[model samples]
Each structure stands twice: as structure tokens, then as C-alpha cells.
Target: MFIKDYISKDYPAFNASDSIEVANEVAKEFGYSHVFIKKKGFYLGALSQQFLEESAEGTLATLEHHYEKFALLDDGNILDSIKLFHTFNSNVVPIINKLEKYQGYLSCDDVFCEFAKYPLFSENGALLIVQINNRSYSMTDVCRIVESNNGKIYGCYISAFIEDDVQITLKISSENLSSIDETFERYGYNVVLKYYDDEKEELLKDRFGFFQKYMEF
Candidate 1:
């Protein structure tokens, strides 16, 4: 989703000549990691809250050299903000135009709200985390495996990379989770983590009961 409409101006962007005390006050008020800096309608960068505290006294002008240049362009997708949030360790991301105009900002809370609207989060489903070799993995095969087992995939994505294997986390709706897990294994995928109801346990109990009866013969 394009972020043009989601731009928020609730967080103040201080001018370059703005007082350090005033800037710090606004930063503290908003509980943000950094306060945006702008001059002549163009964004400069950001001054971290910790640096603002150390500043004690001075104008933003004095700390121009310390500004951290990080911003998301206006054309960026909402998903893009997540990476920037993690990369910069900031709760807020500044938005700017291609011509260097300071537009507004996107809050971490707002981004999450946007995410919660997507099927990956909103739909009811069982989640699975499976591991596969990087060289042999195919997204097509993953989707095929789940769908062939009478499962409907709400969403799935590669969640991690561990040495030679990558873990894919999937949110799928189905009651045949036991069969799905076994199917993944048969297709060379390791079902490392799975979340579901008690169907698997019930199946195990029934199998154990059958084993005990057979032993009595």
C-alpha cells in the first residue's frame, strides 16, 4: 500500500535553528527515538533523543554534523517502513519527497495498524514454520504442498536464514495439520514449529491405543 495517504504530521519537525530545549521537549512528548530536522522546507536528518539529552544546551544548528541521514521517500510502500524501523532502531521514520522536501512521518504504531488489516494478520489460521535448504526451496512447491493437503494459505513468507537453510512461516487454515506436517516432511521440508488445535495429540492417542491392543494379541 502506498504511504501517501498515511503520512502523519502529529509529530513535530523542528527547524534547524530551533532550540535544543524545545526540540527535546517535543521529542520527549512524543516518545520517539529521534526528532526530525528541517530547514527551508527540506529535511536535514534526525537527532537522537540520547544525543539531545547530552546536548544540554545549544541550537539544532550546532549539531548539524551529528544528524543521522535516514528517511523514507514518499513513494515507498508501507511494508518498506518495517525494514527501516528495524534498521534504524527508531520508532518513527521521516518521509521526504524526491526533491528533498520534508513531507511527514510514519509511526511504528500506525504501520502495525496497517499490517493488522492484511489477511496475513487478520484471518484465522494455524501458523507453521518449516525449514528447507536454500538451494532446493521453491515458493511454488510450498504453496502447492499446503493447498494439496486441503489447506488454504492466508499468507506465507521467509522469516529467517540459518546457515544453509531458510525458514518459511505460513499462516494456513485447515484441520488436517497432521497430514500437512507429514506431507511437508515427505517433500523434504522440516516442520520445525507448528501451532494448531489438539488434533495431532488426539491422533497420537488413538495410534497408541491401537498399538496396545495389538500387543495383547
Candidate 2:
């Protein structure tokens, strides 16, 4: 799942001498929003389509163009690459080698797909949304509550509301909704949402009849 596995060798890259027009054409042909601009084993920056359309030059090297901070990495694990990709909001990131030379670009989708295989919990799990006292957001309290109810805590997402209330979204491996709901509610943990809660099937069917009339050939 590392960058080495997902790095795309086929991605179209441009050289310093390449015309801005050529870069735009390559981007259009490849259906890419941005094109990598490189010089002899080194990545300079990227050329964006939006910048090309707005400027008079409409070229990669024009003064009117700008690029976001390039995400760089020498060698890293899959976890490290995923963290960098999310932080930079980049689709293609440059991977550097030990020699500080450009190796290739990692496609964001490929990297994410690999990381998703290892999730916080297994697919057969339920999520509980609990509202606790504003001061109680510690892991100890969360573990105590889940263990008391014979539920195994798979993962937890802790967040604070705008009104200073603490909310803990705990993922448990228990599918017994009635028992889990009653146990948490007894402990004053307001259950706002449940991930395993069954949806109202008729809701989608009812809307489909109304939506079908708007469809035209």
C-alpha cells in the first residue's frame, strides 16, 4: 500500500522547454486537471487548467499561473503517504528517492484504495453516538462504558459541539441494537445516532414515483 506500489509511470509529465500549449493539450488528452512540470529528475511545480484559461499566456511558465505547495517524500510507509496526501489535498504527489531525484507520481485514488483495506473496525460492526458531560472525553471513560455493557470498543471518534458539549462516536462490534441502546441510555449517554440502525425503506420508494415524472428522453 505504499507510494511505490501506486506510483503511476504512465502519467504525462512536461519538461521546462515544453510549450504551455503542449501542456494544456496533454492535460486535456489525459483528462487531468493538472500536469506535472519537471526538469531532469527534479519536479519543479504543477500547471493548473484554471490558471491557463485566465491568463493571456495560457502557458505553464506564464507569470499569471500559480501552483499549490508540492507534496514531497523520500521513502515512506503506506500510512505516511496517506497522511501527506490528505494534508495537501493533492491528486498526484511526487515521490523522491534517497538521492533527492524524482521517481514518479502517486495517484491519490490508488493509494486510498490500498489504505481502506485496513479500517478501524471490521465491516460487521455498529456505531454508537454518545453525548457525555462536557468534561468527560477521556478514553478511560469510553472503555469503561463499553466493557460494562459487554460490548467491545472497536474505535472512537471524539468531537466537541459548538455549545461545549462533548460527543463521542464509538464503534462497537456488537449488533444487538436493543441491548446496546438501553445500556448506554441507562448510563446517561444520550444516543443520538446508530450506524447499524435500519433505514426506512419506504422513504426511497415514495420519492422515486415523484422523481420519475421529471425524467425526459
Best by lDDT: 1
In model 2, pairs of residues that clash are none
lDDT of 2 by residue, 94-198 (tens): 667765566777766766677466444444567788886776556686777677767777677775574767888877766456687886777777888887623
Residue 118 in candidate 2 has what lDDT?
48
Give the Å shift of residue 79 in candidate 2: 5.5
Model 2: lDDT equals: 0.66
* Residue-level lDDT for 213 in candidate 2: 69
Model 1: lDDT equals: 0.91
**Which regions of candidate 2 fall more than 4 Å away from where they truly are?**
1-5, 53-59, 63-65, 74-90, 97-100, 119-122, 152-154, 159-166, 185-188, 197-217
Tens digit of per-residue lDDT, candidate 1, span 1-217? 7988799988889998899999988899889999999999999999888899989688999999999999999998988888889988999999999998999999899888988998889887689999999999999999999999999999999999999999999999956888899999999999999877456777999999999999999
TM-score of each: 0.88, 0.67
